[model samples]
Target: MITSELLEKYTAVKKTFSKNETIFEEGNLPLYYYQIISGEIKMSNYNDDGREFIQGIFYKDQSFGEPPLFLNQKYPANAIAVEDSEIYMLPKANFMKLLEENPSISVKIIENLAQRLYYKSVMAAEMSTQEPEHRVLKLIDYGITHFDFKKDQNGYLINFTRQQIGDLTGLRVETVIRTIKALEKKGKLKIINRKVYR
Candidate 1:
């Protein structure tokens, strides 16, 4: 239950944030590692045009803030909660000790990082070879692998804003909107209130 003993040994702190709240800003000192207890946190970077490009989204049981642990510097991207969320914080030193004590956690962390890299590669490949519609489908497939994108009589239910989808898939917002509309027309997808039913 996040006891003081646990806090002393691991430098853990429990935090809750509301939707649209920034957990940590880019370029700020990366003093702690974070693990999501519940809800969604998005990691995003700013482009030259000052647009936010979503790098990744962390869900329940995911850990982030490890890049800074490796680099010994500030955060590369901003972490913001997409919904109300709880996270466990660990200072760098204590986190390393936990890794040393339990090697399996380290393995899981490495695997998570590898998966993130794989997603980026897939996005790049899709951008070069696939049409926008196919790209969206591929992304939905990936999400199904990672989350629960269930299909019913109507379609699949997937959570994401069109802008967020565009940010991750490297599609323009207009293109994403048009592609969703096309999918709806084709009877392959139905988007209602920002949720994709496919």
Candidate 2:
């Protein structure tokens, strides 16, 4: 991610959204480079039956929906604020100019994109062949590494809710709950004070 100092130079506007607000919807044309300054955002899509599948969750200091910007295509999923949030929006032209002027930032962006691609590949394989428990654990582990989740004396605490876990793992919420309890019993994770840690 680019530092705030560098981002400030190119930021076109600062925008705020309320919880559950859609920042952008699927099939929208890419226009801005969005970087979160506070709160959480999820890139997701809903099935025909209205079940949500989260492509990714992003927090403060992270950027989302960049692939479409670079590819000159429409957004593949919706970005919604999970809570009231502030974000920096850089015009697409300005974002490209910034990347051209800053090679290091461009390299960092490429690395971040590659990491996302790797995560998607791994999750795709897991969803197709892995059991619920395995899929859940893989999702948590990926979040810990990719999202910079922190550890305490107990373990690395995962911040996602059960519903979010289900969405990310392509499982039903009931299944996610059962799988998590099973994981706890198997010593794979701990649910301390109702929060999952691993």
Evaluated with lDDT, which candidate comes out highest? Answer: 2
Model 2 regions more than 4 Å off: none
Please give, for residues 100-127, the per-residue lDDT of candidate 2 as tens digits.
9999889999998998999999999999
User: What's the CA RMSD of model 2 in angstroms?
Assistant: 1.0
* lDDT of model 2 at position 107: 93
Candidate lDDT (C-alpha), each = 0.82, 0.94
Q: Model 2: which residue pairs collide?
A: none
Candidate 1 TM-score, true structure as reference: 0.86
Clashing residue pair totals per candidate (backbone < 3 A) = 1, 0
Model 2's TM-score against the true structure: 0.97
Question: Which window of 10 residues has the lowest lDDT sum in candidate 2?
Answer: 3-12
Structural similarity to truth (TM-score) of each candidate: 0.86, 0.97
